[model samples]
Target chain A: MIAFGILAIVALIGGIGVIVARQPVHSALFLIVNIVALAIFYIILSAEFLAAAQVIVYAGAIMVLFLFVVTLLTAGKDDEEAGEELSGQRITAGVLAILAGGGLAVVGVLYPSQRIQLGLPQNFGNLRGMGDVLWGPDFVYLAAVALMLLTAAVGIMVLNRPPRKKADPEARLKERES
Target chain B: MMLLQVVLLVIKIVLLIAILMGGFAYTMLLERRLLGFFQLRLGPNRVGPGGFLQPIADGLKMVLKEDLMPDGADRFVYRLAPVIALFTALSVDAVIPFGAAIHIFGLTVYLDIANPSIGLLIAFAFSSLGVYGLVLGGWASQNKYSLLGGIRASAQIISYELAMGLAVMGVIMTTGTANLYKIVLYQQHHGWLWLPQIGAFIIYFITGIAETNRTPFDLPEAESELVAGYHTEYSGMRFASYYIAEYINMITVSGIAVTLFFGGWLGPWLPPIIWFFIKVAIFLFVFIWIRATLPRFRYDRLMNFGWKFLLPAALIYFLGTAVFVSGVL
Candidate 1:
């Protein structure tokens, strides 16, 4: 319990540190740090898979994309300037930000278990145990989920990566030649 | 156990975030060093001890840098895209576990955030949202190139992410759980999935690179072609945020490879944490090595690879492994 309290404190500190940091990159860096720590916290609660997925997917791939875009161009440190009034868009953005905050707040309030709890290792960090519990009786549900995953894998690939990059001239020529 | 769990989770978030942001700073240094090494030129050596303070200097420069918005741009979405991209990227860390728990003061500290059994799915969900950043950023920029870049990126990420998911599905089907830690443990019990699942891992790695817009798959930011891609109009620290986010994402993908294929933190002769880092580092090096070695695939070839080559192969591998595993089990 004492350790979780400390982790919560650290996450809060890191959260605040992100905004307080002078450099935009530093802020992003702080945010990334805060996230990784949060994943570790998830693990302490026996959510072992969550922690690994968090680090593996979130902390790893997405951030790399962000950096790739950021550095491919001019990266300066002067992003702290306030935006101009520029009509009601500013108000809209503020409203949207507030709405997001409100949503998080609502979720937080509703999910009290998500809050600081006493030793919360509902199960040990073992997938085999989870499988035994979740799939032992729920094999049908497991198969359903697997099917869903298969569909998601296929759907996203097809609908998104359409073969249109060469609809212009060269592709047509190659097609005709072939 | 439940009482102490919450307490321990709180501590882990703090440390993990600190480590990630800290690592982000250092990763900048590492990339610069590697870039200079590749270019056969000395990089920044003026900052703290061997340019180690370079990130610090860069940080100082960012706050002092200018923030500009182009005229006739969608002000709201433009700014919002970077924030969303950054947030989504950072959020993935919510699922990764670093080490075993230590029991102290009746509180056993967990080493991750949400150990959701479906954490692997959650990670992909966040990544799906990440493309919105590029799409929004490009659309908001109100420029043709930026818009095109955004279009390409959205298409690019959505495509590659699918292949990546299919590739990962191979692992989940074989291991029989979407839980990443279990996947790692599964590797430990069985041999490294990489040995048998080499095809899935390759496709996953390639798709991940494309998803992250790394070189040989970086048409979104193709300097000669797309200007600066989605952020052609961004300047100063807002721009810096994108840069930092990319390197961090690089680390993220590398971490995935470490976890999914390299038996994260399960190597002999080292503690789990050390093993995890070593594995992640090797993959990180691969990222740069690929950059230095391969030429960017033409846009059509990239799409073909995803659709013709990757998709079918991933599907076959996934189903084949599932049947094989189900029969064996």
Candidate 2:
């Protein structure tokens, strides 16, 4: 419980830092802190596989790409100098955030009994258990998620494909003859 | 009794750190001496018998030198980078089982620090995080070359990491566990996984070399182009920190490779820990041998090989392993 409290504070600070840090790279790093803290929370909850996956996927891979892109393109650039392209965006975002938070708070207060129990099964968080869950009854959901990610990747590839050059009629004839 | 256990653990940790530090120093000397021998030249032999004390002199010089922070550099991140590097490097050792459990004061303690179920994944996580140190150090240096080095290092590590992970899938599937200790025990009963999973071993070695940023894949610090790469702007102990991180990473990868494929800590007429170190030493020798034998890969060629060759090969091998493990073969 003490560990939970400390990690909760860390996660909150990291979350605040993500938005407050001026540099994009710094913000990405703060996001990593938040992600790592969340990963530890998974461990405390006895989700060892989930915790490792969380760090590997979020803090390790995704955040590295985020930092790579930010450092590559936004080095020395001041974030505040970029004027908002959408008018009244900040006000709209603030209102939406408050509404989301209020909704979540209401849900928590109304359904406190929905909380998960601390006791878990013996094989609840090992690799074998994860494998069984993914490949057993929940296989379809895993496949669906994987297929969606694949489709998105292929879509990006198509979008980024180089422009095709027009084939000359003479060159076509020569190629056919050859 | 509980307090004694805690104290013993603390002592074990301190001893491990000391051994690793000594290992790092000797490894550096070995690389230098071997590189000289490969080139038909005498290596550093002046400091002590056969250059044994060279690392001590080098350490002193590093500590005594001035620490430089470039103008306009991010001072906070600049200092934080080396700490991150050393921290991640050291932490990876926590999960590596170097020997069988031994009885001490009526307590059965394993030779490693922790024996988590996700031991392999923890090592992977730390290795993946290792890139941040180089990336941040390069970026904080405020030098364009340093930034380029950092970016290159991240891209290289990330690209090879996919194949590396896949390369170990065969062993993981065979053992049906990610626990390092279990993997080694399985190897002891069966033969070393390397003989059966030769392709995976080769892929792992190639990717490991690239991940370590060692020679042949040493483009991260390619002196010909990036001027010492990510650590170009760093000086003194900061520079040594990066150096130590690299060497320690080499040791960690070698340890993992031995644990996974080389029948770790298993041999005739030798202590388990001694056998483990011998295996790791051989891996280190191969690392240095490859350094001496091959030139650094061209940037495009490196990426092309990693993505085009290694990734597909690893995927195919992994699928085959899955089939075999499923009793389809």
Question: How big is the positional error of residue A84 in model 1, measured in Å on the Cα after superposition?
Answer: 33
- Model 2 scores a C-alpha lDDT of 0.91
For each candidate, give its TM-score against the true structure. Answer: 0.67, 0.95
**Model 1 residue A48 CA deviation in Å:** 15
**Where is model 2 more than 4 Å wrong at Cα?**
A77-80, A102-118, A165-178
Q: Number of clashes in every candidate structure?
A: 75, 0
Model 2 Cα lDDT, one tens digit per residue, A31-145: 9999999989988878889888988888788888888888898666453667778999999999999999999999989988755766887667667778889999999999999
What lDDT tens digits, residue by residue, belong to model 2 across residues B1-329?
Answer: 89987987898889778978999999999999999999999889999999999999999999999999997798888999999999899999989998999887778989998899879998998888999999999888888889999999989988999999999988999998899999999998988999889999999999999999998999988999999999999999999999999999999999999999998898999999999999999999999999999999999999999999999999999999999999987
Highest TM-score scorer? 2
True contacts kept of 1: 0.02
- DockQ of each model vs. true complex: 0.05, 0.59
TM-score of 2: 0.95
What is the DockQ of the complex in model 1?
0.05
